[model samples]
Target: MTTPLGGAPLTSLEQDPAMAGGDADSGDAGDLGPQPVVNRTIGRRHGHHGRNWMGHGRRAKSNPELRGGFDGLNFHDQRYANGGNQFSVEPPDQGLCVGNGFVMESVNDVLAVYDKSGNELVGPVDLNTFYGYPAAINRSTGAYGPSITDPSCYYDSDTRRWFQVVLTLDRVGTTSSLAGTNHLDIAVSQTANPTGAWNIYHLPVQNNGTQGTPDHGCDGGFCLGDYPHIGADNNAIFLTTNEFALFGSGFYGAQIYAISKKALVHGAASPNVVLFNGGDPNIPAPAFTVWPATSPDGQFAGARGGTEYLLSSDAVFYDSGTSNTLWLWSVSNTRAIDKAPTALNLDVSPLTVQDYAVPTSLVQQKPGDTPLRDCFALTGCAPTYLGYPNIVYPTPRPMAVNDSRMQQVTYANGKLWGTLDTDVLLADGTHGSGINYFVINPHSGGLFANGTLALPDANLTYGAAAVTRSGRGVIAFTVVGPDNYPSAGYASFDAKIGAGDVHIAAAGAGPWDGFTGIPYLAGNRPRWGDYGAAATDGDRIWTASEYIAQTCTLTDYLTAPMFQCGGTRGALGNWATRISKFEL
Candidate 1:
């Protein structure tokens, strides 16, 4: 078993005797320099491994079969199988692959499980049949009331059990849609063996529910919140009470919500829970929960929250051009989330510099625009320059992470490897076109390397889908080509190398390749859901279309061709589309 750093303990920066002094820029925040990466793996690991068995890819060539029977001819809108986003857990040793599954349209959308092997653990079982989605939403406001939906799965080595925390929506009918009467469901199961029975139990919130409104903004509509994240800490599932924010519009705010292990999941409700709520105008109403570690120096210290919730700031509110920053809160324990002085508190302390005066990548200079520095590698390509973050310092910097984006600022391998979107620097250097890739250390806010890939003139922006980190490399992709045309999803790549390691080639420069034949996925499309597909896991090597699910071997990705959200009939109505899984 991969043990957590420092026994996975929780420590507060506020409680740290040595870390008490200095501002975020004091340059003394615990040697934020790049240290060798100890754990080669990223994110939580999983268990329960068996042999491999191949299964034929779903062969239905029609859209009806691809879209789970929804063909857009009728208003066959199916609410989220459980009103929550998908849950994922990667195996420790076999960190190369991860397991991800969601509550789908069955048994009232009971949660299901899919691991690295692409086998369904829950295998056609309704999550509700085992647990239940007991919460509701507020009709007028579209706010979610209490009853867990934020389901997070973790492997417990101590008991060999999988722990899940359901974050219940707190407002009845507050956010009504086909996605089940707006509720959260956190259930626990011990499914170590694929063919074994699960010991499933639904966890509960204190006082039988939440105390505040559905956390919908006063104006309502798009400015609403949902999607809670739960983590293990202090022997409890540490939850954040932050609002779930709508993306692109870029708004943020949420607090810590906690649930105890002894309560609900263990069949008892004790010690009222408390939730943190923050007030800010530019930002939407804070989500009712945020994941918090009791202390900063503890094991959970320097660890980033795996999930986020936010209130959409731009949709309902008029011309708030500013992208709202999602505020976060934390709960020390589940049972005391709503009742303790320390339960719901802000995670950012020492008043870290709110504005680092850092320019968005859209306004930064390109590495090529400057001189070649750092390390560089070349193929048949021309000799180029490689840069490093302008400076190096030690202070925790604010980086937003979500299902849409996985941002990390860590010191590893004795060289600070900062990774972020290339678009942030394009507008200033390259007219915001082509592949945008950069490496900048967050601690010092320095620009290490900034440049575009030598693609065959593909206008790349953040449209390149998702960005994820592997061993010592960074991978990002986007749907590149004309905005209106069925563009190709191009994957940009780069990796850090050790000096003593093989200097087979230059560092940043390499032969550019493509994951050819990645056709534009045309199916059920939503305004935002269709924007870009999410990567299967943190490896970020490949991103699968939302409509497609692969077979057991990860050889091919399959889906329906007629996947449409609001548009009229087409493939979104009845055609299935499958694509070969090829690396770029």
Candidate 2:
């Protein structure tokens, strides 16, 4: 277990602390110098031919297999098995951003855009192709590119540009293996239109200075920037990631980068990029998944040359099991990043909030008819099940509900709102997956509200919230357990009242029967999505989450060509994504 820097809350974090510089340009202790980067867009994305998984490739992760005939449980009343903009993918790393009447949704490796009336505008394009690399699975040839995953996006209304970011571990020189060097690939729309041209920028975050990046002295060869997310204030956009060893040991903590929005909007040849000293530098211990918050359009912080706030939890970071200390971070003076050494600063303060701990349960799924297992047992699935003739998946498998890290966050109503997965003791004394949320006023270093959000017998994972300028918001999550089967659900909340009941937006069709949880592949450790993404478009809150959209019997699955169960899924996995919207 890794221990964090501080344990107690810092008393009196008032604005204008009378440090060396003013509040915006205070240049506090342990502040690192900013690095610069150059970039250009390869070209406009080709056509919208979103060639999905064809159940090919041995090591391919997202070969979805549609489920079927479970223990007779129906999640929703939607006419079709799948719902609106519903599609197949494994471990839906949801990415959603709404702006200028356009909606964009990006999952594990695919992306698409639609109008307010649900008219398809742009993609369903693979991330690789969009990033100017070969698709994850080349449609014509069975070739692949470096792995790309964990995507996050936001529409910076201030600039009328949409920004999308993902992490890619470069393949070892054309071979289908990791090169131990990774980068944060970001694409910015040239205009407010989603179907228009875009510019792509790469930040070589291996931190070993291999790809023109700064050397942070990584433990292994280089570092992998996992779970990349983006947010913005009025003047600049910020990206954060969890640094881990690309090929070996070390979890180097979260890395942050601040870029000038003005420079990016104009497609500058070289833009000023501020790379902060992360966990490896021993600066105030280590900050884990310090998520940057997105504010409603035109509601950015105007004081101190525009301040962007981020929130993180050190509870699970120290592995002390539970904690109440929440780290509140602010980036000041982003307006002048175009000038050298212009006070692009980071300030961290630990605020004592509600206690939150990791979930005590394994996030179990509903009892279902194990068709994959049934076939492996009845017909002795040979090479199909990794050539193992002795593999048997149980009736009701358990889904992995990993650690309690901060999930989704937003800055609205002059406060910071965020939540993460945790454990809660119910009336029956049984521990269940729960949520701990906090609404903080960063200037004064105080929380306006914080509480637990949960249901009686279900588990909620990857909960995300989006708020309007008036404080009206929605919380989206994946609800599953002995009774629910990983359905897309949500709740309503505001500045005064906390979250309401967990409402199901789109019901799950079956259990999460992905390859990662198979005993032969991994050790029954079910692979789950990192986070759900929600954004505010005008007065509406747009959200997306992972769910099971289709199910089929073993006979239907085997009879279907290439295991594309009636166009519901692929071969090795059956995860689906559901996009939703709420009126604020």
What lDDT tens digits, residue by residue, belong to model 2 across residues 1-584?
11112221111111111111111100112212111010100111111121111111011122121111111111111111221111123455788888888888887666778876666666556677778885444423434466677788889888899899998767765555567777888898898897899999888888887768777665656776777889888877899987765545556778888988888888987788887756745457357888988899869877787788888876554334567788888888878788953577778888887777766535568976545555555555433522444555566667766456787788898988999877665434556666777778889988787877776667777889888998888877888878888888777766576777667777888887664444433333355676887888888887778788777776665652534456565545677777777775
Clashes of each: 117, 9
lDDT value, residue 139 of candidate 2: 25
- Judged by lDDT, which candidate is best? 2
Task: For residues 1-584, write the lDDT of model 1, one tens digit per residue.
Answer: 11212122111110111111211110111223321111011111111021111111111122121111110101111122233221111000000112232211111123344443334445333233345333233223334333332233443322333454443333323332222123334544434332344444322222212333344342222222343444444335544433422211223444344455444344443523444454344433332223222211112322232211111111112121112132222222232333453543333211111111111111111121001111111221111111112321111111111111212222222222222222212221322223223343333334444433323222322222222333233332222221111122333333332111110000111111110010111111101111122222333232221121111110111112111222211111111111112222
Question: What does the lDDT come to for candidate 1?
Answer: 0.25
Task: List TM-score per model, in order.
Answer: 0.40, 0.82
Off by over 4 Å in 1: 1-116, 124-160, 163-182, 191-225, 240-252, 261-272, 280-299, 302-345, 349-525, 528-584
Instruction: Single out the weakest 10-residue window by summed lDDT for candidate 2.
Output: 35-44
RMSD of 2: 15.3
